[model samples]
Target: MTRVLLLGGTGDALAIARALPTTHVYSLAGLGRVPGDLACTVRVGGFGGIDGLVRYLRDEHITLVVDATHPYAAQMSRHAFDACALADVPLWAVRRPAWQPQAGDDWREASDWREIVECIAPFHRPLFTLGREALAHLHDIPASQHWTIRCLDAHPGNARASIVDARGPFDLAGERALFDAARIDVVVSKNSGGRATEAKLAVARERGIAVVMLTRPALPDADRIFDDAASARDALQHWLTRP
Candidate 1:
């Protein structure tokens, strides 16, 4: 059985774990909440840094590594690339492609969190999906404006908002319910492109709401880069079979 290390958390990571050929799997997650019935063995929290990860790769005798973390999770991706290079282990990045708006879609692209805040202020009621940590940016906007914020954790910020705590791959129905309940007029989100959070865009389109989309950061130099679970699994199999 070949030992493989999966950098987990994102939906793609979980998907890849299910698709792996072997049972000798080691998964890492940064979030405290672990997915139930994940196919392989799991480890939570950081690996210190590049040096720590390199040591882990050697100590675990990991044959291959898959950088299947969140697209915004740049630090871990960089560490994985560096550590794999140091350990002479094969590395691959599974990144979902960014979502592009079709005609009649009211979309505005923002470069960062600050820009997202600025873009939302003029709207009467904004639905924010920039993550819980970013709720602080909403403070710049007054409480007079209605805002609906969705996140995995409860938001602890000064902004007066109707916070919805939920995990996603949210469906259009759920997103539409939230939007309707909140009377949302605008949708704000990171272009953290994946099917998981795509429902927000669907809801926005259906309601004819404007969307503030954040751009994704660049990826590191990877031996193989794939956009979906099947491709990622095939790449992993190829690497594992290579002499």
Candidate 2:
């Protein structure tokens, strides 16, 4: 069986791993915390850097590499590209299509994270899905303004707004409930487009809430990027079959 190294953590990566065909898969998870029932053998933490990754590929005799890491994780993507080149191993990047605003959607596009903070000031009740790190930026925005922040982890010191500590793959019903409970009128989120957090968009569409969407950061020069798991699996199979 071909040995495959998968750079993962995001839901897209998990999907890819589940779709792989009979390969001996080794998954690299960046977060110290591992998900329940991960389908393959897993390795947590960084591979030091490019040099380290190159050595690992050679030592383990990995035939191919699939980078299905988060879009925000640009550094790992760059390292994967570089290390694969050095090791002469095939590499692929699996990226989901970004969410675009629909007709009648009240969407304001922010160029960066800082711009997202400024854009939310005009709204009375803002629902923030930009993750926990972004809460500090909104500190001066005002506590009485009513903000709802959702994140994977709990924010202990956050006093300005209501925090929802939850993991995602969230559905429309849950999103609607949260928005209704918070009395949210505005939604702010990064364009970190994937099915994992797409319920926010769905809720916003149904409620006609304004969305302050941040654009995606650029990706590295990956071998190829596919929008779905089936296409990614096909690419992986082609790579494995190639002499």
Candidate 3:
């Protein structure tokens, strides 16, 4: 009788989603492409908020919640934690560790946008891999700086910036070419721990350019937590199948 509700968006979430049974639900925020291949029922859009989520849990008879959302999605993770508590359902999460600075990494931690802007003020050409969030501040780009933003989709950036619509799992050689061609002196990125987009960090490290990394936000505690997707998926399947 146990039914799972997976709150997902990132690749890690998708991997976990693939392991779910047909009866379980995989939910998305309607930003990226919905996978046509998932066996589990895909639920697009939000559940309103904490109250709405609680109602959904009760109505759908969801006994457990898996928070496989992005590391930066602190709000949604909090909502899942609260909603599960209200509905008296178990809440589990996949907490991926953040990427740490290596030997040659010239990394600078930024708690917020203000700090990020200040840290990169000395650079003329900066590459941003922080998604569309940076697009909002197009007008705020400093007079001396030019931004090269790489996101999932293309956008017509203003005079101060240009958008590169591309996906990740970027290779070191390619990233090196990008840095060299753009004359990039700095990189602005979220410390989203994964191999997919980590090439930029290596590229920055070798060039000795500074990387202004956004620190991970503190998330609410879960009933159970897994470090990676494979473990979470295995645990869910075993829990569901075990007598």
Candidate 3 stretches greater than 4 Å from native: none
Task: Give the per-residue lDDT of model 2 (tens digit) for 142-182.
Answer: 75577778877777535567778888889988888888888
- State the C-alpha lDDT per candidate: 0.79, 0.78, 0.92
CA shift of 4, model 2, Å = 0.9
Report the lDDT tens digits of candidate 1 across residue range 1-243.
478899987777877777664455646655647766666777877788899999989988897888888887888898899999999998988888889997669998888766876787788788888676556655665766877788788755445667787888799888878887889999888788778889888878876889988788777988888888788887776766888
- Taking all chains together, each candidate's TM-score versus the true structure is 0.88, 0.86, 0.97
| Candidate 1 clashing pairs, residues 3+ apart or interchain | none
The full ranking of all candidates by TM-score, starting with the best, is 3, 1, 2
Candidate 1: stretches off by over 4 Å: 19-23, 137-141, 155-159, 237-243
Task: Compute the lDDT for candidate 3.
Answer: 0.92
Question: Which lDDT tens digits does candidate 3 get at residues 14-71?
Answer: 9999888799999998887899999999999999999999999999999999999999
* Full ranking by lDDT: 3, 1, 2
RMSD of each: 2.5, 2.7, 1.1
